[model samples]
Target: MDRSAPPSPVSSYSARRGLFPENEPFAHGWLSTEGPHEIYYEECGAPSGKPCVILHGGPGGAINPTMRRFFDPAKWRMALFDQRGCGRSRPNASLEDNTTWTLIEDIERLRVHLGVEKWTVFGGSWGSTLALAYAIKHPDRVEALVLRGVFLLTEPELKWFYQGGAAMLFPDAWERFCAPIPPEERGDMMGAYHRRLTGADRKVQAEAAAAWSQWEGDTISIRGPEARPAKFNEIDFAVAFARIECHFFMNGGFFPEENWILNNIEAIRRIPGWIVQGRFDVVTPLASAWALKSAWPEAQFDIVWDAGHASTEPGIVDALVRATDEALRL
Candidate 1:
């Protein structure tokens, strides 16, 4: 496949493709990790077909049904799982032993346990970060990569979203994000939220969780509040999402040094890859995607003009599906 040429814009067509019809996993179960955590996983699509794994965003984001629609069930054996402390995973939201390195090991464990030798890796947002980490660590096991809303968890990226770069665009939502923290502590928003989120006071934790999670929900879509996922409002989901995300962000994604993903890009440079990014994604933004592309030019890069950070956006859905379909030929 000639990845030299960028994919034509999806909006250029009369009709843009949407997600595949909703489908359930044919097989689902929990895998016990070396530690106390037990990860939840499900498999859908053809039992004997091209293998692929879908990594959901949020470092804390759990798997959702809509994620299954990105691939052709008849042609792709898709695997989706909850990373460490989110979704159906056991000990809900417990940050015990959770780190970027542990999650990468868990992915390897899942691949071996499922009997998949080499499979395409599909991820977005934080998921995209994990996918890159995993591919770099175990390049031989990855056949290809499909990434969206690229987030490297770099200091600047974190400062932009949590500190105030995104705030410049959504000041209203940013005001609410800052409301939980006092003016004095506003200087370090993530640190302030982390202290409250991980603090002993349940009331404080819940309050910070709601505010932190809602902030992401409010700005995730180009369509605004109406398009934000309703799940973000639930306290249980917010706790896991905010806590884990905060934990990772506060700790610099547990990376040895900053810019780890791009520094290690050469490890997977030969692997087939696709990067789908939203032109107006305030959450992950376009700069990270452009940076990744600059480092790994072999991967196909597609920008969805009408989309934002969320995968459900029509343009993103079309571009992702098209990327996955093209991976089938590999």
Candidate 2:
């Protein structure tokens, strides 16, 4: 289905590298975590500074250059990595050993590889999911958290994304996303989309990809009249994106049948955290952020009044930048 949400009324994507000058010529490389996969990452800011890892969204989305702006070069060392089988990483969406547990383990391995005893974790959307899972598994290794668009991977959240919960706001996009297939296929939405999106017919793939991208874009971002269609590498982006999300969806996103966050609330409650949510976020509702606040009453939750899901949204980006700066102070 079209999972792309419209960009917020916010003006444009965040400027890259302009925020930090001294950290010129950022470094990029791969880290072999001694696991089944190699992770692609970029390092900016000060090497000897406090360590802060940034996780990008999408089970398959690559880390953009703007992500580095969240950190203060003089105060914190910033690390951004495309998760396994994702951007920069080899074997994109290979599905050999990619799962939530594998990703959690990957973070621990990355920590040891980076030679850090403890470091702060910063992530948004699916990245937030990985951060929480990693922290819960190894609480002592996490100094703090800066979570945005917090997603708990609960059944309800999954239903909202795949089913019709958010359709009220973007029914046109949703309808287009599901149009490539027959009515019978709607029940197994992702499965049906996967078949046509990966089918031999170029026409079918193009239609499915466009529809899916448009649907997601409409809800997440506010499109302008002059906005053109997004052009993606079908094999590299569309196929991999579909497989990874489906892999997680069919398996219920690797979360326990019950809400693990609620089940283990007491443990994560003590961890220092800042929850950032967009008041108008259709991808992940504000309710999830409030629910998280209820579970960890001490953690500060910031609501960006006019923003949606995209971190690049002006208000949300500002909050994330502030969160990064806050982490550096500690």
Candidate 3:
């Protein structure tokens, strides 16, 4: 027990942020979406325990195994899945039938497929948008929500990141992101990027995909220069991510109406939710999360001061774990 001596292995614990240890999904499989598209999904923790779901970011981001760790295996039955056109889903990066509503339908379909009665929904970044959309659409099926780095997918929020607002914080990264498109096309970054990302030229698509993905990686986490950005180099993964993200953002998330989340808040007001946001999150910004909290004041909100947009941040990881635990209602 010497104060200065290294702690023994039995007593030692991970200095990593978050209360939960990294765990693996015990089972996984593919859920076929409408058409040839198949969505990849996994299950972890006790089969008869409280239900929970992980809504991954990127609109096209894959579900990381580490995301399964947020819940205690003994206390929860958790589900994590990749949206259409991303992750282990087949037909890598195909944009056919991929849209915001398509994803919401996919979620409900996954739940029915899993036989989950109701679940505490967990999502961050674009995931949050999907989570909210799903909750509003089917309030009876949602037990609760744990949202991080919230993105409402509003037109103004789109402008903040793609247009000029976030550029104020990371001018260098923004410069690189904007460098690919001509000035005339700069007025619509999403439209401009979509052209190259979906264009016939593989070389051009790959280039735009990397640049688009890198800009997000570079600015998302406030980690030091030594910390590596999330890997987005795989051409297929990059292209799908960039293209789907641009596709959603350009079409304003394909919402039936503007400010859709707020407009439909009453439907989800009774469904409890907790927001964990980074104060310095340039990717989605804290303001949007705050606005969501304001609209849905029934939800719990936390602002992590030292974190950025990535849920990988220590503060966010811890907050998300706590929220997941809280959702159990025990």
Candidate 4:
């Protein structure tokens, strides 16, 4: 695949692409890992099609049925699994032994269990972070990568969204996000939220979880909070999503160093990859994607000018679907 020239912005053309029709998974089940966690996985698309693995965002974000629509059923065999504590995975919302490294191992376990030697990796947000870490660790197992809303889990990125940079743009939502924390604790927002998210009081944890998840739900898309799905506010989903996300963010993604992904870019330099980022994505933002493209020049980068962080946005859906279709050549 030639990636000498950067791809055009996904929103440039009048004709827009949409997700493939909804399809049922050909095979679905739970895999018990070495630890107490049991991962939920489902295979969609053709049984004999090109193998691909889809990684959902949030460190806590569970896989949804809509994610399976990104690939053509006739040409791609996509496998999607909920990370340790999210979705249908067992011991819901438990944080024990749920580091980035363990998740990487879970990917490998799933791969071997499925009898696939190599496959394409698709992820967005924190999913992109995990994909990069997994690819860096086992580049030989990755056939290609399709990433969106790139997040490298750096301190500046964390401070931007969690602290004040994003707040400058969404003061209304920011106020709501900060309402849960007192003025004294607001200075260290992540720390404050982490305390409450992981606190002994179930009420405190639930309150913190709702606030954390709601803030993200409120800001993730260009359409704003009202446009976000109602699932974002559900108590069960909010608890797992917020708790696990705060846990990962507080732990610095469990990377050995701050710029581990960029520092180790050489591991997958020759691999064919595409990065699709939203121009107005306050959640993950564009700087991280730019830095990633600069570091990995071989990968094609497509900026969606009118979109935000959510993968459900039309422009993002277009870019991702096109990227996956293009990956078929690989």
Clashes of each: 0, 20, 0, 0
Against the reference, the lDDT scores of all candidates come to: 0.92, 0.74, 0.83, 0.92
In model 4, the worst 10-residue window by lDDT is 2-11
The TM-score of candidate 2 is 0.86
**TM-score of each candidate structure, all chains considered together:** 0.96, 0.86, 0.92, 0.96
* lDDT of model number 4: 0.92
Model 3 ranges with Cα > 4 A deviation? 1-19, 224-229
By summed lDDT, the worst window of 10 consecutive residues in model 3 runs over 1-10
The order by descending TM-score is: 1, 4, 3, 2
Instruction: Give the winner by TM-score: 1 or 3.
Output: 1
lDDT by residue for model 2 (44-158), tens: 8888889988887767566766677777777788877878888769876566778899888777767777788988999998888888888888889989999999888887887
Determine the C-alpha RMSD for candidate 1 after optimal superposition of all C-alphas: 2.6
Candidate 3 per-residue lDDT, tens place, 1-330, comes to 012233357743355346466667778899986687998999988888898888989877888767887788888988988898888897788888888888889889989999988888989899999999999998999999989999998888888888888888888889999888899999888888888988899999988998888888777888943343455767777888888888788777898888988888999988888989888888888889889888888898888777888777777787788778788873
Root-mean-square deviation of Cα positions for candidate 4 versus the true structure, in angstroms: 2.8
Query: After superposition, which runs of candidate 2 have C-alpha atoms over 4 Å from their true positions?
Result: 1-26, 33-36, 194-210, 222-235
Q: 2 or 3, which is superior by TM-score?
A: 3
